[model samples]
Every structure is written in C-alpha cells, then in structure tokens.
Target: MKTLGLIGGMSAESTAVYYREINRLVRERLGGLHSAALILWSVDFAPIAAWQAKDDWDATGRALAEAARRLEAAGAEAIVICANTMHINAPQVQAATAIPLIHIADATAAALTARGVARPLLLATRYTMEKPFYRDRLAALGLPSLIPDAADRDRLQAIIFDELVKGVITPDSKAAALAMIDRGRAAGADGVIFGCTEIGLLIDPAELDLPAVDTAIVHCEAAVDFALG
Candidate 1:
C-alpha cells in the first residue's frame, strides 16, 4: 500500500475520525489484520482557529503547507487534509508537495454525483458554507450546493466550533441540526453533505432519511483507493 499523508487537527475530534475511518476501510478491504500505511501531522487547533476567526487564510495555508512538506519528506505518497474547513488550504498544501493532495470536496462531489444527487444540502463551518473554495469545487464537478440560511448557518458554526470541536455532543444541538436538515429538504435539497468533518458526531448519515454524503468517509475511501493502488 502507498503511504498516505494527513494534515489534520483542524479540530482533533475530526482528525481522529479520519484516522479511524481510513484504517477501518483498509482493514475491511484487505481483510483481517490489514491497515493503512499513513503518516499524520496533527496540528494544534487553537491558533489555527484564531487565524480562521481573523480571516487570515495565508497563515493557515502556510501552516498546512509546512505540514504537507514534512509528510512528504517522511515518505507519504499522497496528502489528505482531515477537515472540510481546512481544505481551503488544499492548494497551498498541494503546491508545496510533490505527491497528490486528495481533496475532500472532490471526493464528495464525486460521491454526490454518483448517487445522482442534483443538489446536496451542505452542513459545515461558516467558512466552508460561505466561502467560494468548497462550493466552487463542487460547481466545477457539475454539482450545485444547498446551504442553510444565515441564521441557521450561524447555529451550525456555533455547534461545530464550540461543541463538536470540544467533543461535546448534546441532544439539543442534534435536534437543531436535524431541524436544519429538514428545512434544507423542504428547500429542495435531495441529499445532505456532512460538510464539516465532525458533523457525523451529531448525526449519523446512515440513519438519515435522505441521501447523505459523509465527507470524512468519502475522503477516507478515496485515500484508501489511492494507497492500495
């Protein structure tokens, strides 16, 4: 298997999910005792969060680019950024590395398109939802995106940063998120994208009534495919 490099800890919670899911997928595919060959560089989220809050993407990109370079030097064959929000720096990381940077949005767009979802409701951090990076990626893949309104977007941001990042999951938050999904469905969203890496902690995509794309899983699957090839 090829070594996959991960730029993680945009929030440690979601990075753990990526670690677990990637290994799980490798094991399941290759049978018992098999696991992914991967290198993970998990960053401290606090300073990154502060930069994000300040809209200092250049700093964030530089940090992730450094991580990618380290992983490449350590013999990782492909790079994966663990969080959806962190993928805003994908280009910087990619430019800094020789190997492939497996993008979460590209994998997600492929998954959504394969599932025949015309418009997928996006539930993520405000950066991912409001910024052009992720949505533009999807559009380039021939997929349009649906998102919660301004107020609901704020709620999602709070739930992700304040609660989910801290590993706090509350029933009230889950209910509120579900309500947003319901509203998105009402708004003609045929599927839901767990655009935030940690969103799976709040809602199980498998249990959702509508078609759901859990980007963490999709991203891992893509990485595993590349690794095994």
Candidate 2:
C-alpha cells in the first residue's frame, strides 16, 4: 500500500472522519491487516480560521504550503487537505511537495461523473460557495452549480461554525439545515453537494428528496483508493 499524508485539522472535526473512513475502508478491503499506511499532520485550525474569518488567503496559503512541505519531508507519498475550504491553497500546497495533492474537487467531480450527473447544487462555507475556484472545478467537469441564497448561506455558516466544527450538534441546527435543503431543491438543483465537511454533521442523503453527496466521504474514499494502490 502507498502512504497517505493528511493536511488536516482546519477543524479537527472532519479530519477525524477522514481518518476513521480510511481505516474502515482499508480494514474492510484488506481484512484488518495492519490497516492503512497513514501519516497525519493535524495543525491548529485556530490561526487559519481567524485568517479565513477575515478573508486572509495569503496567510493561509503560506501556512498550508509550509505544512505540505513538512509532510513531504516526513515521507508522505501523496497528500490531501482534510478540509474543503482550505483547498483554496491547493496549488500552493501541491507546489510545495513533489508528491501529489489529491484534490477534493477532483474526487467529487469524478463521483458526479460516475453517477452521470450533469448539474448539481453546492452547499458550503460562504467563501467556498461564492468563490469561483470551487464552482469552476465542477463546471470544468461539465456540471452546473447552484448556491444557496445569501440568507441561507449566512444560516449555514453559523451552523458550521457554532455547531458542526465545534462538534456541538443540536436539534435546531439540524432543522434549519433541512430547511436549506428545501430551498436548494427549489432552486433547480439536481442534487445538493454538502460542500462543507462539517455540514455533513447536520444533514445526509436521506434527509431530503434531493440526492446529496458528502464531499468528505467522497474525498476519503478517493484517498483510500489511491493509498490501496
């Protein structure tokens, strides 16, 4: 098996999910034979989150690039960022290492293509949704992208910040997120992309009539596939 390096903890919440999923997949695939060859660099998310709250991509990009270089030096065969939003710096991170950086967008687009989806709704941090980089990736794969309304984006961000990332899930947040799902369905979405890893904490495929894709799960599956070689 090849080694997997994780650029993680831009909120340890989703990072843990990625770790568990990789192990479970490997164990199921290989039947508990020493699990996956994994190396994780769980960085403090607080600094990056602060910059993000202020839209400081330059600082975050530099920090993340440094993290990628460190991981490469540590013998990682290839790398993956644990959070979707942090992937804004994916190019920089990839440049920092000779090893591959498995992009979340690549994984997601591949899944969408495999399912033959030509269009889909996107739900994520306001930065991720409003930003061109994220949607452009889906568009590059011939998928149409739809985003939530500004008010819905605000509500979703709050759930992500206060509840999901903090691991403080609550009944009220779940209901509110479901309402957002309703709005997305009305917006002509073929399906909703739960773009934020933490958002998956509040919603899932069965909660709404629209098909849902969890980016974290999709990304982890991709990383596992790459690692299994």
Candidate 3:
C-alpha cells in the first residue's frame, strides 16, 4: 500500500473525521489487521484562519506547500488536504510534491456526476462558496452549483467556524442548515454537497430528501483506492 499524506487540521474536528474514515475504510476493505499506511501533518487552524480572514492566500499556499513537502520527504506517496475551502491552495500543495494531491472537490464532483446529479447545492465556508475555485471545478464536471443567499451564507459560515469547528453541535444549527437545503431544493438543486468537511458531522445525508455527497467520504475513498492500487 502507498503511504497517504494528509495535510489536515484546518479545524481539527474535520481532520479527525478524515483520519478515522480513511482508517475505517482500509480496515473494512482489507479486513483483519489491514489498515492504511499514512502520515499526517496537522496544522494550527488559528494562523490559517487569520490568513484566510485577511485574504492572504499566498501565505496560506506557502504554509500548505511546506506541509506537503515535509510529508513527501517523509515517504508519503499521495497528498490529501482534508478540507474543502483549503483546496484553493491545492495547486501549490501539489506543486510542492511529486506525489498526487487528492482533491476533495474533484472527488466530490466525480461522485455527483456518477450519480447523475447535474445541479447540487454547496454548503461550505464563505470563502469556498464565494470563490471561483470550487464552483469552476463543478462546472468543469458539467455540474452547476447553487449556494445560499447572503444572509443564509453568513449564518452557515458562522455555524461552521463558531460551532462546528469547535465540536459544538446544536439542534438549532441543524434546523437552520436544513432550511437552507430546502431553499436550495426549491431553487432547482437536485442534490446537496457537504462542501465543508465538518458538515457531515452536523447533518446526516440519510435524513435529507435529496441525495447528498459528503466530500470527506468521497475524498477518503479516492485515497483508499489510490493507496490500495
């Protein structure tokens, strides 16, 4: 098995999920004592969050690139960013290493396409929702994207950073998110993309009427496929 390199902790909550899911998948697939051979470079989200708040993507990119390089030097065969919004710097991270960077958005888009979802509502941080990086990826896959309105977007972002990242799950926040999903459905979204890694921790796809894609799951599955191959 190839060694999977994970650049995570853009909020340790979701990073933990990625780690758990990846190992769980490997164990379930290979059975017995089999598990993923992996390395992880978990970053402090405070500085990364500050850079994001100030729109300092260059710094963010540099930091992630450095992390990728370190992982590659440590014998990682592939890289996984483990966060949807941080994918804006995916190119930089990929450039820093000879190994592949398994992109969360690309994996999610592929899954949506395979499921015949042409229009999916994206629920993520404000940066990911407003940025062209993610939407353009979906468009390239022949899938158009929908996002919440300004008010709802702010509410969602707040819940993610202020609550979800901190491991605080509230019924009120789930209800608000469900309302936004309903609005997206009304606006012609046939499916939902949990674009933020932390979203899966809050909402269960089984409860939603529309099909939902959990990016963390898709991304981890892709990594597992790559590793085992």
Candidate 4:
C-alpha cells in the first residue's frame, strides 16, 4: 500500500475518527490484520483556530503548505487534510506537494451523487457553511446545497466549536440539529451532508429521513482506495 499523508488536528476529536476509519477500511479490504501505511502531521489547533478567527488564511495556507512539504519529503504518496474547514488551504498544500490531495468535498460530492441526492442540507462550521470554497466546489460538481438560516448557523457553529470539539454531546444540541434538518426538509432539501468531520459524532445518518453523506467516512474510503491502488 502507498503511504497516505494526513494533515490533521484541527481538532483532535475528528482526526481520531479519520485515523480509526482509515485503518479499519484498510484491514477490511486487505484482511489478515492489514492496516494503512500512513503518516500523520498533527498540528496544534490552538494557534490554527486563532489564525482562523483573525481571518489569516494566508498564514494558514503557508503553515499547511510547510506540513505538506514535510510529508512529501517523508515519502507520502498522497495527502489528506482531515478537517473540512482547513481545506481552504488545499490549493496551497497541493502546490507544495507532488502527491494527490484527497479532497473531502470531492469525496462527499461523489457520495451524494452516488445516492442520487441533487440537493443536500450542509451542516458544518460557520467558515465552511458561510464561505464560498466548499459550496462553490459542490456547485461546480453539479450538486448544489442548502445551509441553515443565519440564526441556526450561529447555533450550529456554537454546537461544533463549544460542544462537539470539546467532546461534549448534549441531547439538546442533537435535537436542535435535527430541527435544523427538518427545517431544511421543509425548504426542499433532498438529503443531508455531515459537512463537519465531527458532525457524525453528533448526528447519526441512520436516524435521518433523508439520504445522508458523512464526509469523514467517504473521505477515508477514498483515501483507502488510493492507497490500495
């Protein structure tokens, strides 16, 4: 298997999910205790979050580009940025490395398309939801998406950063998220996109009425496919 480079630790929580899922997929596919051959460059999230708050994406991109260079020098065949919000730096990382970057949006878009979901309600951090990078990428892929209203977007952002990243899961937050989904359904959403990697921890796709695409899962699956090839 080719070594997959993972740029992670936007929050330690979701990176754990990516690590576990990627290894599980490799074992399931190869059998006999097989696992992924991968490298992880886990950054300190505090400064990264601070930079994001300050809207310093240029610094963000440069730092992640450096990480990509290190991973490439360390012999990674491909790179995966484990956080959805950090993909804003994807172009920088891609340019800094010779290997492929397994993009979360591309994986999620493909999954949504595979399920015949023309329009999915996207649940993510304010950066991902409000920013044009993610949505514009999906639209370019021929799958437009819906985000919650401004008020609910604020609530969801709080739930993600304050609760989910800290490993807090409350019944109230889950119910509120469901209500947002219901509102999206009323708004004509045909499916759900767990746009945040950590969202799968809060909302299970199995419980939703609409078809759901968990970006973390599909992203891991795509990475595994690349590694195995």
Per-residue C-alpha lDDT of model 1 across residues 1-229, encoded as one tens digit per residue:
9999998887899889999999999999999899889999999999999999999999999999999999999999999999999889888999998899999998999899888898999999999999999999998888889899999999999999999999999999999999999999999999999999999989998888999999999999999999997
Q: List the residue pairs that clash in candidate 2.
A: none
Per-residue lDDT tens digits of candidate 4, residues 14-87? Answer: 99999999999999998998989999999998889889889999999998999999999999999999999999
Residue by residue across 123-223, what tens digits does model 3's lDDT show? Answer: 99999999999999889879989999999999999999999999999999999999999999999999999999999999999899898999989999999
lDDT of each: 0.94, 0.86, 0.94, 0.94
In model 1, pairs of residues that clash are none
Cα deviation at 49, candidate 3, in Å, is 0.3
Comparing 1 and 2 by TM-score, which wins? Answer: 1
* Candidate 4: stretches off by over 4 Å: none
Global fold similarity of model 3 (TM-score): 0.99
Per-residue lDDT tens digits for candidate 2, residues 1-229, read: 9989998896899899999998889998888576888899988888998999999999999999998888888899999999889989998898888999999998888877776666778888989999888999889878879888899899888888877889998998888878777776777777778899887877777666766788999999999889987
Off by over 4 Å in 3: none
Per-model tally of clashing residue pairs: 0, 0, 0, 0
